[model samples]
Target: MNPGSLLAYRHVISNAGPSDAAPVLVTDTFPSGVIFDSAVGADCTGGGARCTIDRLAPGDVITFTVYGRTDTTVRGTFVTTATVASPAENLYPDNNTATAITTVRIFVYLPLTLRSYRP
Candidate 1:
């Protein structure tokens, strides 16, 4: 990734339980050095800061695509995290959270000045 460049990320959430999971909510906070842009998916909302998914069901798999741009001065490693939860107890909570990392490099150009002297 490069500074001022657009970046896209995807998050997948699945209900592996035998029973349905209702009123599910999925959230992802924008990582530092990146500005939120937009997202797409079912029941998806929120942009320019975070993303949210409103519901899910047993054996349901949902994919979310989030768009963002790298800050003009951003560099180094950036990590983004997403989590899924519901008021109902999750039989397996270990897979509720996911994370992704990206490296950014910025290129800068400087002008050179030259002068000639006569003896």
Candidate 2:
């Protein structure tokens, strides 16, 4: 199988409040087809929640949506910060440039495994 055909999935983590954040960095990248289907903590550092997923492939679209509980104080936030590498590989363009993933909406409540082709 081609590496471009692999599926990668990860929970985009970052600090949020008001002012500038301390920069919640993502060190590793997920392989294509692997879905992050489990509840994860809102903490900058991954903890508490279980990070689990089935699997997926590239070219697949994983949509995310978020909902806040009634008693919850602060609403949960989700963000994606990844850029497509050079060569202008296999990617669907919205206008002209590579697909810009700003944020995945958290609607399912539970953590979901999202799949995308690896390259």
Candidate 3:
């Protein structure tokens, strides 16, 4: 497939309210072990005050274009960790801690075509 035609997308699924929270996207290539791109707090997950496929809530889904373009096809690992803030009544109100990571899902989105390398 045409690398330019392919785009990367992502979303954060949670069971809480005010889905306005921000989401971060990180991409890492395998074998070579490299991070091609990393976007922090990208508001591309919902449409308004939201971005991506749709307005997502708990069990909802969304998508975004993380890699707008590429010259070749490669394999990599995508790590998604949802940084959330706990309520004041919770044990730990601050969501910056490790325990606050609510949802994390990883998968591979392949382009329409694959590029081959010659030995």
**TM-scores for all candidates?**
0.79, 0.19, 0.24
Q: After superposition, how far is residue 9 of candidate 1 from its true place, in Å?
A: 1.1
TM-score head-to-head 1 vs 3, winner? 1
lDDT of each: 0.72, 0.27, 0.32
Residue pairs clashing, model 1: none
Q: Give me the runs in candidate 2 sitting further than 4 Å from their true place.
A: 1-52, 70-119
Instruction: Kindly indicate the candidate among 1 and 3 with the higher lDDT.
Output: 1
- Cα lDDT tens digits, model 2, 1-119, are 22112122334322222332222222222222222333333222122122222222333323322211122222233232232222223234332121223222334357789999899
Predicted structure 3: lDDT: 0.32
| Candidate 2 TM-score versus the reference | 0.19
What is the per-residue lDDT of model 1 for residues 1-119, given as tens digits with 9 covering 90 to 100?
56888887787778876666677776766667677767776445555334445556677898878777777778788787778788778777888888888888767788899999998
Which stretches of candidate 3 lie above 4 Å from their native place? 16-67, 73-119
**Reference-based lDDT, residue 39, model 2:** 30
User: Which runs in model 1 stand beyond 4 Å of their true positions?
Assistant: 42-50, 111-119
Q: For model 2, what is the alpha-carbon lDDT of residue 6? A: 19
3: Cα error in model 1, Å? 1.9
